[model samples]
Target: MSTIYDVAKEAGCAPSSVSKFITKHGYVSNKLGNKITAAMAKLDYHYNGLARNLSTKTNNRIGVIVPFLDHPYFQGLVNAIILEASKISKEVVILPTAYNANREQQYLQELEHNMVSSLIITSHSLPYTKIYPYQRFGKIVFCENSNHQQTRCVFNNRKEIFEKLFTTLKQKEITNFGFMFIRNPQDSKTTKETFEAFKKIFNHYPQPERIIYNCRTAEDGKNGYLKLKRTIPNLQIVLSESDISAAGAYQARGNSDTLIIGQGNQLVSKLLRFTSIDQHLDETGILALKLATEATSTMKEKVNFDIIWR
Candidate 1:
């Protein structure tokens, strides 16, 4: 309940001197500074972040928007961003939208009101047009591919990575394929690009009969495999969107000759001993943070990834 005025009165200094000492905006004698510090401790005074930020016209905080926090892929990304932000003494505020467009828009509106200095969008349900209008408020950076002119985008080459994955599978003499995707191909850019790559490489084979959708967890992976086995009957390979799902598939399929590939190269992938695409999520987080905080010439930036063969 103690305010700057209380601390000032206790320290026998004017409020302006207290403000200068607290905000570090102007020089205060060391004796006065020590007195103010002592008074604050004695009174248990706490500074108001919002009021301070409003007065300074800046918030040493960054907002990160993600679809889910349970997934290791996203958890890794967020952790990396937080670690990098800490180096600059900045804090992170996570806005988990759960793929809700309205929630994302609400956070965007908050950005315009200066709730955060910048926003790092890892996934979004709102279109670029709706998001573009808020760029005047602060830096808006995308962790996925975007063609927005006002904001910067840092993303991986999903299409190219899929193409490489397809090549590797073909070289292994695997033909009949099944893929597990998190969302509808029509709704997800990565899913569409991955499917296209699969089609290009498996042109000689029949259309993938065991395509599974909405596979977001390890249990989904197991259930997807069971479904694929029953439907396709001849499914020889499985590609999953996440390592957690792949871990589930491995559990269901057991030690078999069926080739399995997973994305995100998560800890589960290593434990399951499956080949996975290491998208370098940590690098993505660090780069996204940098782009969000610093000015860059290009509006879009691409980060490279590799397939980690286990």
Candidate 2:
């Protein structure tokens, strides 16, 4: 209920002085500033953020649009972004789309309406062309590899990591392999890069039947493992895009000889003692926020990955 005018009245100072103190737009004497601060504390007064944003055409909130919040990879990125944003007094708004194009488009309206200062899209259902048009409203940063050259992005270096993984498998002479994906590689540039790298290292694409789709949980992994066993019969190795799913695959191996490689290098991977890829997601999140807040050009930064052999 207390406004700047009330604070001014309580402090016996001009309203302009209180306004300057709140906005830090003009100089206010330290002595008067103390009085204004004390008055605000006594009255429990808070500035109207919306009003300020309307006047300045700026917001202190950043929107992060992701497909799934529960996934460990995205969870890490969201947590990192939230922590880093807090240090700079910025608020992070999580927008989960569930890979719904309509929901993703609705979230984009926040940028159009200036509700958020910028958006960091970790994943999406719509293509880059549709998302690219919204950048004119505010800065749009992609956390995955995007085909748009004009959009800013910060992503993990997945291609190099995939090459290293396949090379290691080849060194072991493991030819019959399979892949597990959280989403279809056909729709995801990052996962597509993994397949491209695999093809380059290996002589052929992975068997269509060997690759599993929609593997999010351990149960999905278990089912995927069963399917792979039925189809490949002699599957040498299986690479899962997430550690949770990989853990499931490991459990379902049931004394089988298939080597399981997981992604995310999360707790499940470490506890289970399996090789996993550390995508350096925390760094990607920090860099993505940095680009969303600071970058003016079409900047693309790639965070490195490490293959943690357990």
Candidate 3:
């Protein structure tokens, strides 16, 4: 409950002196500064962040809008961003967009209107057009894909993930394969990357069959599994976009014995004993938060994703 005013009074100095010291804008005598510090400690005074941000033109908070926080990939990313952002004394606000492009754009506008320090967006359904609003605010936007020249981006090497998975799986003596995913571009950096690798590996004669499905909702994976069941009955190998799809495939087959693989490594993937390629999403988030901070504080251009598995 203690405010800066109380500290200023206790220190026998005016509140303006306290404000200057807090913002590091103007100079206060070292002796008076020590007194103010002592008073602050004694009164347990907490600076009003809103007021401070208003005066200093910095929010000290990062706005993060992600589609589907319940998924392992996003949860890992958020967790990583939180941990890294905490180290720098920054807070992260996560708004669930549920892969809705419109809501993602709306939230970006909201963050700008509120003068949040920066933003880290995790989206699958949103395109570059939706991110145009950030231009009006002059805020930094670090989206997925470190390769793309879109001011700011972060994404793993998608093709390398696929190649690694395929090469590793091939070493395990599993050649017959199937790929399951939605025809959406706003998926994962690795999703597209791995798909491309798969395409390259199977571009020869007798390519493996691929089953594509339309994503109905964030929680929709059953249809993908059903589609797989009908297309490639008794399939020995399959690569799925997420844990849900992998679990669905396992259930549809009525066993966990299938060699179904998944990306992002969610709980369902582990529970079903499915093989998976870990994307280190938590690390992705941490790097993203760090990049966003650098972008804001230093006005940097982009922060790239580190390909651990790839």
Q: How accurate is candidate 2 locally (lDDT)?
A: 0.88
TM-score of candidate 2 against the unseen true structure: 0.87
In model 2, which regions exceed 4 Å deviation? 1-18, 27-47, 295-298
Q: Would you give me the overall lDDT of model 1?
A: 0.86
Model 2, 1-310: lDDT tens digits are: 8888999999999999999999988999999999999999999999987778867888889999999877888999999999999999999999999999999999999888888999999988898888899999998999876756777988677898889888987987987888889777778776788888999998677767878998989999999988988888788888998999999999999988789999899998999899999988889988999999974564898889999987
* TM-score of candidate 3 on Cα atoms, chains taken together: 0.69
lDDT of 2 at 114: 83
- Choose 1 or 2, whichever is better by lDDT: 2
lDDT tens digits, residues 1-310, model 1?
Answer: 9999999999998999999888888999999999999999999998887988876779888999999998777888999999999998888999999899999999998788788889999887788888988998998999888866667988788878778888877897877788888877666877877887777887643355678888988999999998987887667988898898888898888766777888888878888789998889888998899988876776777888788987
Model 3 lDDT vs. the true structure? Answer: 0.66
Q: If both were scored by TM-score, which would come out higher, candidate 1 or candidate 2?
A: 1
Clashing residue pairs for model 1: none
Question: What C-alpha lDDT values do all the predictions have?
Answer: 0.86, 0.88, 0.66
Which has the higher TM-score value, candidate number 1 or candidate number 3? 1
Put down candidate 3 lDDT per residue, 17-59, tens digits, no spaces. 9988877879999999999999999998878768667655667
* 2 or 3, greater by lDDT: 2
Q: lDDT score, residue 64, model 1?
A: 98
